[model samples]
Target: MTSQNKSVPAFGYEIIRDYALSTILGKHADDVLYWVGKDIARKFPCSDIQLIISFFEDAGWGTLSIEKEMKDGYIFQLTSDPDLLNIKNRKFRMEAGFIAEQIQCFKGCLTECYDEKKEKQSVVQFTVKWDTKEKIG
Candidate 1:
């Protein structure tokens, strides 16, 4: 599989970044996190670093630091990690496993889902993670 255009962010890249921030800090990212102190703050919400890391570990994406969060645009590299990039154009079953895993971890949310195809007379089901920073505190 190839394409004429390249350099596109994956399906949920921005969402994951936002989720990382909101979940860790209990606040919306008015700007993308980029600096070391800003990054540190993301990990240490009101100075609780351990809990933030624990949250990431529990979520199963492993420990995610700020890496680099661009204010104007996405830090494309940081926003789209290798694992996520690896999954594009993969099998449905594989995608489901990742999605299910993320949902089970509680680092994200499950929104509504509907299947586009019904070829086998079966209903395929899925849940989408929440993609925004909100007041969860």
Candidate 2:
């Protein structure tokens, strides 16, 4: 996917994404955010991978790229500014859920996504796997 040059203020974004949501949601923040991501995906669906990547950039999430393609899944890498990565107790579950639902909608299958934070690399890796047998109707 092509990259976009647009940017958003990290400070304000984090205040809502990391601080406010986490403070209000507390222990359930991750789970709630994941579902919220899915809901957002439903509200704004992307039919192709490029559109999905563009959506991420437009949402000020980060730059998303495909790291690898598997038979039934895909691995995506998300990267942003170093300062964003350095934030304490940051979470990417919302992005993960958005990916899962987006792929499910695109492929018409049951899909799931999980994210792994690589602090050393300052990146988040998302794994999206779909069950071909379980078609979504």
Predictions: Cα RMSD each: 17.8, 3.8
Instruction: Please list the residue runs of candidate 1 whose C-alpha ends up more than 4 Å from where it truly belongs after superposition.
Output: 1-10, 14-32, 35-46, 58-61, 64-82, 85-137
Please report how far candidate 1 places residue 73 from its true position, in Å: 30
lDDT of 1 at 120: 39
In model 2, the clashing pairs are: none
In angstroms, give how far residue 74 of model 1 lies from its true place: 26
Residue range 1-137, candidate 1, lDDT tens digits: 55524344544654555355546644323222223223443443432324543544443333333323332111111112445533232212322333323332343332221112222322223323343342122
| Candidate 2 TM-score, true structure as reference | 0.89
Predicted structure with the largest TM-score when compared to the true one: 2
Candidate 2: tens digits of C-alpha lDDT, residues 66-104: 999999999999998878664346899889999999999
Q: What lDDT is reached at residue 105 by model 2? A: 95
**How far does residue 62 in candidate 1 sit from its true spot (Å)?**
2.8
Compared with the true structure, the alpha-carbon lDDT of candidate 2 equals 0.89
